[model samples]
Structures are given as structure tokens and as C-alpha cells.
Target chain A: MLKKPRNGNSAQHKYPHVGRTVSLASLSAHLGLSKASISRVLNGAPAARSIPQVTQDRILAAAQALNYRPNLLARSLRRGQSMTVGVLVPELSEGYATLVLAGLEETLSAAGYAMMLVTHHHQEAKLTDLHRIVMERAVDGIVAVDTSLPVIHSTPTVTISCPDPHDGVTNILLDHDRAAELALSHLYALGHRQIAIIKGQPFSSDTDIRWRSIQIAATRLGLSLHPKLVVQMKENLATDEPGFLAAQRLLATGIAFTAIFAFNDVSAIGAIRALQAARRQVPEHVSVVGFDDVTLAAYHRPALTTVRQPLRHMGALAAQSLLHSFTSGGNHEASHSVVVEPLFVLRNSTAQSPALSLQC
Target chain B: MLKKPRNGNSAQHKYPHVGRTVSLASLSAHLGLSKASISRVLNGAPAARSIPQVTQDRILAAAQALNYRPNLLARSLRRGQSMTVGVLVPELSEGYATLVLAGLEETLSAAGYAMMLVTHHHQEAKLTDLHRIVMERAVDGIVAVDTSLPVIHSTPTVTISCPDPHDGVTNILLDHDRAAELALSHLYALGHRQIAIIKGQPFSSDTDIRWRSIQIAATRLGLSLHPKLVVQMKENLATDEPGFLAAQRLLATGIAFTAIFAFNDVSAIGAIRALQAARRQVPEHVSVVGFDDVTLAAYHRPALTTVRQPLRHMGALAAQSLLHSFTSGGNHEASHSVVVEPLFVLRNSTAQSPALSLQC
Candidate 1:
């Protein structure tokens, strides 16, 4: 039951000047009524006990002058569902992550879901805590954007990897094999048969599937996949020194390749550096292509022509799938994979294979 | 009773090594035991029925050789706590966010907290859904990273922008103003008076704090500040078009300034591009400095010398704060801000103002 309006009919006192003014706060203060009480009456908080007719009239008049609105959070709590979805990312400060997250956020928000973001770079260290957040039904569902997941769980998870799915988990992936294919095929079509691939790294614990796919694709391409061309980087972070070093080794081997496809854009950039240092003009002496088409790709000196992944679209789909599963009540056991394709982004970085050393 | 050894006093002739060498599946097949039952006994799961002494021996023998472990989820659930945190970000598929996240991941993993990341870029739309996820208590705590928040809650929030400590939130900021001071001072010391600044769009949301700081510092240094030096940008993504346009405008202004302080590494790179296009040699014709030292800043043709923020460290620290408060059982109510200072990294991007072309 709502409490009776304080000070009986004081609020109803005819204004000293008709319709001149009396702010809600002033009226409440003079009548000794709590702001909460005034707020409730104005916003129509559902309670049975009615305010005196005169007090109600006065409150309405005062509210008209003040033009106050109820707190969004308070109003939302009563609506049965908050239109917000908590987006948990390992980190948003990075470029690649930001792009994908941006895509997801744009789609979700347009559809009317607010994204509440929380980043725990220490999800492994505090699995118990993370699990509580994911499993206890706090969020409608979860999207685990862990590139190198040190851990996976039995809860409803949407994984971004190379096509591995679980019962309650949905996997969305940009086909690594196809991405590699796109790069390799482009170089092959440039009328060059000898192409070198510098694998990024083998240290990503969750990258076994990608490595495996590359191996298979290389075999199918019929290119003599030299173990040497597969220069595996042990370092996780891309460094110019190693890139130069790798290039030096590749050049010294006299492989006679006109194009180099580094695993990712950074590596490709590094390879370009090596090519420049060796006095090899890009697309003239050698052509290079990269993967991921990150923001830096376009901004780079020659601009990178590479493969594009629908990272943002994929992010949106992940959210949509989760929301669908969530709103449907029971588990949508059709757990499967959403594979995004990579498109070759033509840019200054690549050109038709240069006239092979005519001396050959 | 330790369930007396199954074959008590029967160490006679059946001392076969087969039992010890048996695989889990083999043992299960031999004993006709349910895989679940076998797993439970092997993993030390509490089972309803007491294992007969004979069955126990077989299970123990099979376990000792195979080295089976218990399901982590089941074990963690039993313990009633998870050591995980929910991290929410705008996205993780971008460079800056990824790099910073990498740093955070390294630190957080070292300390033992798994990061479960979620991505949400739409600012105004999905907030309600976000609230539900938080209220439902998905993870132990949350880290909001690189997300441009439209509205902040009283919840434990750590903002990326310039956070006012008065708001009772933890904000980690790179001393943009101080870094500007350091860059300008270095240039001043180098015997150059004329300067320019390539401002970032949203370089300062409400007011350009960095610009203001630069003005104040320059004024103190007795160096005249030019209004032309202050270029403002207001956009969401770093599309490079706006940056390029601004640089063109600055160049057209024709006021010869020795150094340009870009708000971020991307803008600085853009400034360099414009300088190059205009045939101005970097550091020779104009010495350039940028802020938010990004990965490309290092590989940038003229390695960029800019301010480096402890981005990853800040992420880890944010996670640590959440864990610290969570386990503290609600006593550490002190919502304080943690500010990480930026460092001036000198590189090939800057040089003494080129000997002014004496128009003699």
C-alpha cells in the first residue's frame, strides 16, 4: 500500500498566482514530502493507496512544470527484460578485436540490444569466477572471443575457431584452409608457380586445426611445399628483426619464388620490409599478400592487398545465434559451425607475377 | 574397513601383468562397468554404491597406468567458486585492442585468472541486455576495455577516456598532457620554436584536453601557439580519409612548423603520409611525433617516437582490481582510480627543426 500524501491537502492550496509557478522540488520541500514519494506519484509507481485528490492535482501541476522523467534503470527492471547483452571480450584495445567487436556491436545495437562489455584477460586464472558469470544465467548467453583459449567449458559457448563444435556450443570460423587457398591461388594465378608461404607461428595452443588445414591445402595445391618455405615463427608478437631474418634465409635459399604469402598482415608487412632492404621492389621483383585485412593493411606504405574476413558480420551472427537460443527457452541443440569466407582484396601490394628473371 | 583386498590370501597364481597394463577402455570392457562409473572411480568422484574390493583393484590398477584426470568443471562446481572474470570490450579483432589484450592476457594468465571476453560495439542500443547479464552475475567481475561508453553505471566501471576521479570510477589514463609536454619540451630544447599538432577526432570529447595542455605548456615555455596547429577530428573509426584531409589542410596553411604532435599513432602515420606526398622529408624538413605509441609506430619507416601507454598492464590491473574486490567479501568499497603514466619513446620520427631556410 502506498503511504498517504504527507501534510494532507497543503499541495492543493490555490497558487498565490494562477499557473505562475511551483517547482516539484519546491512543492515537495514545502510540504515535507520525500522526493521518492513525489517521484512515485508522478511516474505512477504501482501502489494501491491513492494520494488525496487535491494533492494528486497539485503533484500533477508541479510535475508539468518540472518535466522530470523516471530513471531508466528503475523503469527497465520492471519491464521483464533489459535490452542489454553483456559482451565479454578478452580485450577491446587491440585492432583486430576492435573490428570484430565493432561489427557485432553495430548489428546488436541496431536490433535494440545494448552491449555491456567486460574484459577479463585472466579468464583462465579465475575459471571458477568466470564460470559463475557464464553459467548462472546472468547474460542471456555467452560469446567467448578467446583466440587462444587456455580453457573451454560445458556451458553454452560460441567458439571462433577452425570448425570445432560442441553440444551446447556454436562455432563460427573464417575457413583457414580457404583463406590460405585464396592467397595461394591468387599468387598461382599471377602466372608464378613458385610461391613461398611463411607460417605465422605454432605457439597458439588452439591453432592445431589451422596448421593441419594449411598442411592439407599445400598438398592439394601440387606446389612443392618446401619445409623451408614453411618458416614457422616461434615468437607470438611480430618483430621486424625476425621477419628480416626469415626473408634473408628465404632469399639465400635461391627458391626463385616471385611471391610471398605470409600467414597474416603483420608478417606480410615484415616480409615487405625484408624485400625492400634486399633492394627487391614490391610486385616487380616480388609480390606479397596477407590475411585478416586489418585496418593497418590499408594504411601501410604500399597498402596491403589481402584476404578479407567478415569479422564484424561473424560477431553479429554469434550474438544473434545466442539470443535466439536464449529466447527460445530450451537448448537449440542444432550446434554447428558458421564459416565466413575470405575475399581477395586487390591493392598495390600485389601485381601479375613479374617477368621471371629472363636469364632463366 | 578398506574393503578388504578382493583376493585376500589369494596371491597365488593369478599375478598377471595384464591388469596393470590395461587401458581404461580395456578395463571397462573387461569389468563390464559403465564408462561413467569407471570415470567416477578413476577421477575420485563420490559414487553412491561402495565399490567391491575386486572392482576397486581393477579401477585403481587401470588408473595408475593411464593417468586419467577428473573433469575440471565438475570439480570446480563442487568447490562452489570459479576463478574467472568477464571482460567486455568494443572488439578484440583490431590491432590496438589485440596488442593491449595480449599484454593483459600474459599478465593475467601468469597470475591465474582466465579472461572470458565479449564484444559489443553498439553504444546506445544493447545496454538493457547488458544490465541483465551483469545482474544475473555471469562472471565474478568485469573489465570494460576500449569501449566508448555512452553512459556509465555506478557499477564497478573502469573507463578508457579521461575519467574524473570525482565520479568514483577507476580510470587508467596515459598522461596525454604530460606526454605532450615531454614532446614539445624535447623539440624546444632542439632549438625549434614553430610547431604544429595533428589532433585526433575525439582527441578530446567535450574539450581537447591534450590541446589545452599543450597550449598551457607552450605558453609557459614562452613559445607562441598557433591556432592552425590545433586540428580537430570527430569520428568513430580511423578511416584515414579525415586524417589525410586534415594534413592536407595543415600543409596548405603554409605556416612552416618544425614539429607536429599527432594525437595517436594512426594520425601520426597519416601526418607522415601527407608530409611525404608534399615532398617534405621526415625529420629533415619536419620532425614528427605521435601519441599512443602503437605497434606500427615501431615498424613505421621512420620509427615513430611517441608516448607509450601501459595498455596491457592497465588491463591486467583492471582484472586484478575486480578479483581483489570480489574475494575481499565486499569490504574494499573504496572505488579508486588507477592512473598509468605514459613514457616518451624516442625514435627516428623526430629531429631538430631543420635549419630555417633563411629567405636571403
Candidate 2:
């Protein structure tokens, strides 16, 4: 015989004004079972093994019949762990951010953490979004990629390629200076003293660093640094069109150069197109080098010679730092920051400068 | 006079073993105010406007000193709105997925929803991950891209290019058959009867549909698709290597075909590379047409003529479905599914058949 529910007649009034709301207590009472037993079966806890199979079946049937849904927000509040991290990116269509995001996703998922993704195309909106994410406690931590906005919070933040000197923020900076040196040095070795540099955007983190490095390295190697040959992109983002226009600008200047050092692989391909359009053969009329060695870089016509940044590794390290901060109870000091070195990859794009042949 | 919390010293014992946990009640007591008033000030409620500035300042200072957090989980539980959505994708590193994701992010963020991202590389794992996402109540709704996984649950699901006959699940399907007709018809109009097809991955959803359409269109146009000329990739993903290898295999067979229809732009570029290696001039010796006019297709040495799919539009539609379902109280009937058509884009990679040139 089942005992009568104390509030059976008033059960309709208990959760009024809704189209069927089911709670653990309601399901427990309906199935004539304890709330603990219902929870075990519903959550599949270890203690659920002690419950009889018949009782578990009954509980499940009752839950389905009533459309029971465990309140996730309430459960998380009780557990004091959201088990989610916020990821901020400027753009997802770009290969650099997506590649990094892949690695970040892999690591976070392996650690049983979900990633909340938010993108802000404009720079000013990024800070406002960051503030909202923190104020709402939307995530346990944050990892920002290719964003210039600094997370000014104690929310255990990790930034990739976005250096913020703010205390407690761990920055993952790339060694772009080394990448520039490698490209310049390779051009010098190929007997090319006069080279054009298609600089990246003014607002990009790599532009100033790469340009400064190129200048110093050129000076040290006793090579000519012609101001007319350098083409600074007029925009804030690096795309093939800007690269195409930049190469055209360089060509218009008519300063002779045997090689071109592009800001990145897309620009290198664009520069090659401009050269080909002028009836100039790559590596015969001009050898081109690029940076960031995107997937298309390897498949481009001349198979670009570029500097490969460890994008995935940087993403992994950023996730690892945030994870460490979580486990260490928000210390944020254990892994303050990290710097990764870029590598030089030689391919068919670069060859012995045409000046050597002309001199011969 | 600061009034002690009604619960008093036992509050310390209630939440023991933590590094400075501050709740509304604790902050209220510290600031000599009620929890309701403190909540109003912190949450910026209408009642907060009536509170004195001095009292508000005191409350804020005390809360800051105690490192107070509003327990967003509890707040959301009471509000009955998570304001978050889950995004499931096979790969984020792929250009197609990232492009779709950019549009999805734009729409979802504008609608004030956060996206929880998860990637399942293997087909079998997608269902399992979907189950986990739903069971955990990780999001209020879901948008799956390029996945064949059916959203069996009633969690307001929207899928792109993945059709499920199941009720209440909205699918955003692409018109691959029309795209195939467009490509084959173009080649046939150029007086090419024997055509080669670089098929996409065997397991991909579009591969079979596209191939079947190609065969039907070829039959209708009185063209022959030679068995020896078809190259089916072993992998389940499209990339440049397989396209290059497939073109090489066709070349080795010595089968005479004046035109090639590649599965995508990447594979088309690869096929062009293989043709170039064999000293066959594109559009001079053979005409090539690719699908999905990716950004690189335009910048490629011989700008590829291809079919263009509106990936960003599909993404936006999928998001719209999910958002609508949310507003309609998960009815799922508001917008059941959508089918988007692909368009033909003519470029430099294709021209009059080499056979016509030879005859002339």
C-alpha cells in the first residue's frame, strides 16, 4: 500500500503558472520513492548501484513521463563550479585564431571543461564584452586570442599573442623578432642585399616587432634599407587583397629589389601574383618569403618559404596555464607568462637572387 | 550600528574550507543593510535608484573588501534563462566550418547568447557528445554544422547541411544536386563528352549526393563519365593532398579527358598543381572547375572557375531557426528546415575544350 502524499490535493498549486515543471521532489513523491534514490538514478551516481533495478526503471519512467529536467544552474550553484571557460577571439575565419582554438578546445575538453566562445570584431567592444563575461560570472576563467584588449580582472585570464602588463594576467607572446631575423638572414645568404618588406598592418602585434627586427638585422648585415621598397598596409588586418595592393604599391615605387619579405603567407602569394602579372618569374625576377606558414602556404604555386609559428602549441600552453590557475585555487602567479620561438622553413619560393645571375 | 547576520557565527561553519567566499547575507551584515537592498544595488535593480548614494557606496566598498560574487548560477536559476547555446562541429580548423562559425557567432552574440563549443572528430563520437551536452544542460539550444548526427532531443536544435527526417529538428540542407548540374552542364556546353571528377571524401554527406547528381546531369546532357576517370578519396575529409594524388592517378591511367570537376577549391588547386607538374597547361590542355569558391581560389595562379555555396547565409539561417525556437517555447515546428541553392562563378581556370581547339 502506498502512503498518501501529505499535499496531494494541493499538488497543482505547488508549482503554479507553468506548462509542466518537474522537480526531483515531485518525481520522488509521484513514484513513492525517496529523493536521494531518485537523484542517484537520475544522475547515475555510484550509490545508484544499491538501488534495485526495478526501482531505477520506475524512477526513469516517471521522470520521462513528467518531462523532468534537473536544474543545471541550481546544481552548479550547489557545486560551486560552472566547469566552463570563456574564449575571446577577434575573428574565427582567420587561420591563426582557428588553429589556436582547435588546440585550446582539445585541452579544455580533455580536462572536462566546456568553452564559451564570444567574438568581438571591433576592438572597443572586446573590453565591454570581457567586463560583461566577468560581471556575470559566465566562466571560471578566460583565454583571449589575437586580441589587443587586456582583461582587467581577477578572473584568472590567459592571453595568446596579446601582451597585457596587468598583474595576474598570463601572456603567451610569440618570438616574431626571431622570425624576421631568420627571413632576413636567409635572403642575405642567397646573395640578395636589396630586399623589399611588405609590412603587416600598423595595429597588429607582429608589425612593429617584425619591422624593427628586419631593420636591425638589415643594418647588421650591411644591406641597403630603401624606404621606398617598404609597403605598410593601410588597414588593421592582413588579407590577400591588402597584400595585392601593397605589392602593387611597391612595384609603383620602381625601387629594384631581388627578393620580397612579406608579412605573412597570404601577402607572399599576392606579391607573387603581382610579379607574375608584370611578366616576372618568381625566384628568377624576385624571390618571396612569408611568415606564419598557413596551410595554403605549402600548396601555393611556388610553395612559400615562410616562418612557422607554433600556433597550436601556444593555444595548448594558454589553456594549460588557465587550468593550472584553476587547480591551484586562483593563484595566477605560478605560470606568469611564456614566450614561444618561431621556426624558419625553406621551400621553393626562395632561390639564389637574380642579381647573382645578372652579375655573372 | 552594524547588525549581525541572523544566522550569526554558524555562517562561518556553514561554508567552511574555502578561500574567502562572500555571499549577499555576509556583505549585507558588513554594510549594515538587508540582503534585498544589497541585491538591488549589485544587480542594478529599479529599487537601487531609491537607495541613497552614501549607502550604495558603503555597500559597494564592503562587497569589494569581502570579494563578493553574485553566484551567477543561482541568479540564472531564479531567472530561468541561461542565455547560452551550444555549437557542435566536426572541425574548427577547417575553412568551411570556421566561415560558418563566424556568421553563427555574429547572429548568436547579437541575440545575446553565448556559444559553448565542442568538436567531435569521429562520426561515432558526435552523438555521444550531443547526449552529454543535452544531459548536462550546458546550453538552452544547439546549432550543429556539417554533422549527420540527428538531434533526437527536444533542445531546440538547428543543423546545417545535415538532414534528419526526425520530427522537430530543423535542418539547413545545401542544394548540391543543382551545383553538380551547373558544373557538368557547363563542361558539356563546351563540347566535352569524356569528363573526370575528383570526388570528395567517401563518407562526407555531400559526396554521394554530388556524385549522383553529376551522373544524372551527365546522362541528361549525353556526356560520358568514364569509370577510370573518377577518383574517389579514401579519407572522410577534403584537402589538397588527396586532390593532387587523385589527379596523378587520372594522369597515370592515360585516360583522355579534356575537363575535370573537383569536389572543392582546395582539391582543384591540388589538381592544377599535378597538371602543372605533368606539363599540361590549365584551360589550354585541360579545363578545371572546382566547387565552393574559397578565398584562395581567386588568388590561385589560374583563378579557378567554381560553384559557390553561401556558407555564411546557411549559418545565419540555422542560427535564426534556433533563436526562433527559443522564442516560440521550443515548439520546433515554426521553421522545420531550409534548402539553399548554390551559384556558378566563372573564372580563368576553365575555357573552351582543348578538343575544340584541336579540331579548329
Candidate 3:
């Protein structure tokens, strides 16, 4: 039922003389109504239905006339639920975290929940302090993105791309095994036998599992994993400098490889730059495949062929799961993990191997 | 001088018997101290120094032992000030807003403040609702990024990249005039006579002023901005598609131009893709310069030569100004605007103009 005004303008125009400082007590006094009766009507409590229609209308009219804005903080204090969630990310400048955050924010906002965001910058001490702060502020739940949070608490929690499993916390993860098979099978079908790999930074939660998946996939394809052909990204940089350096190191090894599978799109772009600098044209000499088809992948010069992780969708799923848990009264038995699939995106970066064509 | 334990482990180990539900009253009862005395000591109020060291130590020890966690929300309600700031941005996936948010979070977190982030998604109705939600949540202040908020309110507010001048809001802006001069002057010194320009999307706050500055800069350089050579981006996409489409439109005009100045790095990349598809090599047939040296700019295929806006620093400055306003009791008179300079970044995308060299 359209009981309230359609827009704020009509209410303000009709009550132009109402002051901003009007309180519930003053409104009750002016209407000659009990404070409890007025509160029940204004809050739309179940008991408000028992009140006569005329009295309810009178209470609503008086509230509109007095311009009594409810103090959400004080009300939340009495209710013991802040209706806010805390989000912790490693950093916000990168593509992965930001994309996930965008999806998370969209869903949370639609559900009428505010988000308190804090970046720990991958510092354990800072994470602990921020967690304490958010908990002190009394958020109803928490969403940790690409962060390791081991402590179990009463707050409903969801973790995205977080490898660590904790009791009473739900995890949103990507299908790393399928991701590996998709990338390796594509490269193998392209007639590339000698392939180099770039591993993610050690600090990344996905690094260990992703590398393990890659090794298993390579073995299943009957491809020998050469130590000299693999290099790991050493720095925790937001830019592609680490990838550029890793590719440079691969070239310096004087090893021959027709294809390079990079850790992410940013690093793939960097590796291509290093290949170009070394006079090896992309696809013409060294075909590169990247992971996580970030927004830049499609616009890149060679148009990076990548494995898409559906990052934003994963973020939205995390938010929905967290909200669901709130309604289910912390029922952690239903699901512990939600795994999302990865798809291979074919772009301009990959082509038939130079060596295979030469053999033909 | 260290009143608290260095780490959470020591306190937990020393107080393992304490229950998690302990409160201030329970701690006072356990220690036979008054609630006022315990609160003053725990909160470090000015009157705490007047209490004897023995009594203060007793209060701290018992509070820690009892696991008394002060409810920040309840305390904030009593103090009438929540140490939380509200941040509104158009979207979170883009580089500009995310970078600024990173800087803002760093500064705000360091000052023991939490941030409530909401994305309006460029919808006026959603923005209005979100604004009301954040305000009702009782944030101490607000920071709006690239958003138009003209409403005059009692809350302390700071805006970044907002062109609209509100009566009581402080604006953190990039010097668009200098930005135009930096890009145009660089192209002019390179002897580019016929240059095409890509204007930002209309929804962008910097689009109008930036285009105006470009026109003024072009006139100062004695260069004519032909309508055929100027194209404005139409779509509000997060990728480089709009820039690519704009560049394609420019090419379809069949006008001869030796250089192109794009709105941003993302669009510049798209424009480069379009030019490459048309067989015009970057810096060979045409020199292309981008704006806002995003993280990808340094790693782009041609390594975009662009203008840097220092977005992160601008975000940090906005946060500091908002904090300063709170400390100064909302003194908006001191500074209405904070203008930041732009720098010209030289890279491989731009070089000596092809037409000028041909003429020579």
C-alpha cells in the first residue's frame, strides 16, 4: 500500500515550517499520543496493525509534520544489529579486488546494507587491528577478499579467493583445476610443446594451489615440466613490472619456448612487452596466454587470450551468501564452499607454434 | 609508556579464564572500582591522570582480565560522533575511482577512522537513497568522488574531481588547464600540426572543463581544432571500447592528421587498436598521447605517453581535508578548492610528427 508520500519533495513542501531538530518525544507531545503508540506506528511494528486506521493516519501525519528523522545508531543499539557489513581487501588499485568489490557493493547496497571497507595492505598486524575495529563497530557480517583471516567469531563471515579454511566461515573460490586444464589444453592444441610458465607471487592466496594444478595438468598432457623454463614473480607489485622481470629472466636463460602462460592479464601484457623488446614478436614467435581476463585484456595490442574467472560474479555470490547466513541464523552446515568455474577466452595473443610450422 | 600489551596473544594467554561477554559493569564489579573510574582509565580521559597510578593499574588489569570490550556504537551514540566517514563514488571497477579510494582509505585508516563506501552507479534516485542511508548511519563526514552533490547540509563534506561548486563543500580538483597545456604543449613542441582529439564522456565531471581547457590551449598554440578532427566519447563503458569506436569515427572522416590526443589511457589503448587495424602504426604514421597515466599506461604495448593526474595523492588530500574540517569544527571558509598539478609523461607512443618529418 502506498501509505507514504511518493517523493521527499511533497512531504517537505507540506511541512515547510517543521524544524530539523524535531524529536519523537516532541512529536508525541504535540499529537497528544503515548510514546509507545507513536513509536509502533512510525516503526511499522506488528503491533501497529492493532491501532485504529484513524490513529495510525494521525501518527503518520504528525511525524511528517514534525520531520522526525529516526536516529539509526540509537535504534540499532536497541535492536543489537547494525545492518552494516565490513569488507577487508589487500588493496583496491588492482583489477581483481576492485572488480569483486564492485559486485559486492552492488548487491549489498540493493539489500540496504552499508559497507565499512578497510585495506590491510597484506600486513598481518594491520589486518588484526582493522578486524578488531570493524568488530568493535558491530558489523552484522564481514567479507574478506584475497585476505587470510583464521580467527573464528560470532559474526557471519564470507571469504573470496581466500584459500585458508576456517570453522563457521563460508569460502567463495575459483575452480583452479579446471582453469589449469583449459589453459594447458588450448596451448597443447596450438602445437606448442615447449612452454614457459610464470607463477604468481608467493604471498598471493591462489599461488600455491594454481601452480599445483598447472603441474598436474602438464603431467596429464605428457609434457615434461622443465625447471629452467619456469620463473616465479617475486615482488608484490600492483603493476606488471614483476612479470616483465620474470620474462626477462626466462629469455636470459637462453631456453627456447614457443608459448608462455602468464599468471594474470597484467603480467601477460608485461611478458609481451619483454618479448617485443627482445625482438620476438607476439604470436609470430612467442604466443602468450594470460589468466583472469581483466578489462584491459580485450583492448591490449595482441588482445590477450586468457582464462576468465568471473570475478565480479564471485563477489556478488559472496555477498548473497553472507546475507543468506544472517537470515538462516548462522546455519554453517549447509555449504562450506562455493566454487565458480573458469572459461578460456580466445583472443589474438595465441597462434600456431613457430617451431611446428617450421617442421611442417 | 606502553599502557597496553604489545600483542593480542599476551593478553589472551594471561586472561584465558575471561568470558567474551564481559561488560564495563562486570569489570567494575569484579575489581570493586566505580564504572566512571574504569571508563576514564580505559578511555584515557583527561581526568584519568588525576587518578592514582595504583587505581589505574587495577582498572586496566581487571578490564583486560574480564575481556571487557567497549561497545563503540553505544559509546559513539553517547558522544554524538561516530568515527566513520561515508564515501560515495560513481563506480568501483574503474582505475580513477579505485586509485583515489586506495589513497583515501590509507589516510583514514591511519587516523583510526572507518569508511562506509557506497556506489551510486550514476543513477540519481539510487544516489539520493544511498545518501540518505549513509547520513542516517551517522557518519562523522562525507567524501564524494566525481559526483555532483549540491545540497547544503550541516555535515562536513569533501569532494574530489567534482566540478560543481557547492556552498559549504571543499573541492579537490586536478588543474585541467595545466593538464591541457601539458598534453597540447608537448604535442606542439613535437611539430604536430594536424592533431585529432578525443573528448571524455559527457557524464564525467572533468569532461566539460577539460575540453574547454583544451580549446583554450589549442588557440594559444595557434592550432585550429577542426570539428572533423574532434570526437567525443559517448558510452559510459569501463573498457576501451568507446575510445576505439571514437577513433574509428575519426578515421571514417578521412581527415589527415599526424597525431591523436585521447581522453584517457584506456581510450588511448582502444584508439591504438583501431589505428593498428587500419594499418597506421603508432608513432610511425601517427603519434598518440593518452591522459591519466593509469597503472596500465606504463605497461601498454607502445607504453603510453600521457598526462599524469596523481589520482592517489588527490584522494589522500581529500581525506586529510575532511579530517581537518572535523578538527576545525567545520571551518569551510579557509579553503574552497585544492588544485593539484599535472605532469607530462614521455613514452614510446608519441614521437616526432610524421608529416613534419616528411616535410623536412
lDDT of 3 by residue, B154-219 (tens): 678889988787877889998989999888889999999899999988878888889999999999
Which is the winner by lDDT between candidate 2 and candidate 3?
Answer: 3
Clashes of each: 81, 0, 0
Each candidate: RMSD to true structure?
13.3, 5.7, 6.8
Task: Indicate which candidate wins on DockQ.
Answer: 2
Judge candidate 3 against the unseen true structure and give its global Cα lDDT, from 0 to 1: 0.86
Candidate 1 structure quality by residue, lDDT tens digits, B1-360:
001124454532465432232334555776688777787777666682577767777877766655433332333333433444455655444445665566556555555555554555434454445533542332345566655555544344555544333244566555656767888898888767888877766523313667777887788789996887767765555445565667778899988787887777777877888888999988888888877777777766688888787776776776666656656643434547676777989998888777544432
Q: Can you list each candidate's DockQ?
A: 0.10, 0.40, 0.34
Q: Which candidate model has the greater TM-score, 1 or 3?
A: 3
Look at candidate 2 and give me any clashing residue pairs.
none
Model 2, runs deviating above 4 Å: A1-72, A134-137, A252-254, A274-281, B1-72, B248-254, B273-281
**Residue B332 displacement in candidate 1 (angstroms):** 9.6
Off by over 4 Å in 3: A1-21, A251-256, A275-281, A355-360, B1-20, B252-256, B276-281, B357-360
Whose TM-score is higher: candidate 1's or candidate 2's?
2
- Please, what is the TM-score per model? 0.66, 0.84, 0.90
Flag clash pairs in model 3.
none
Q: After superposition, how far is residue B231 of candidate 3 from its true place, in Å?
A: 3.4
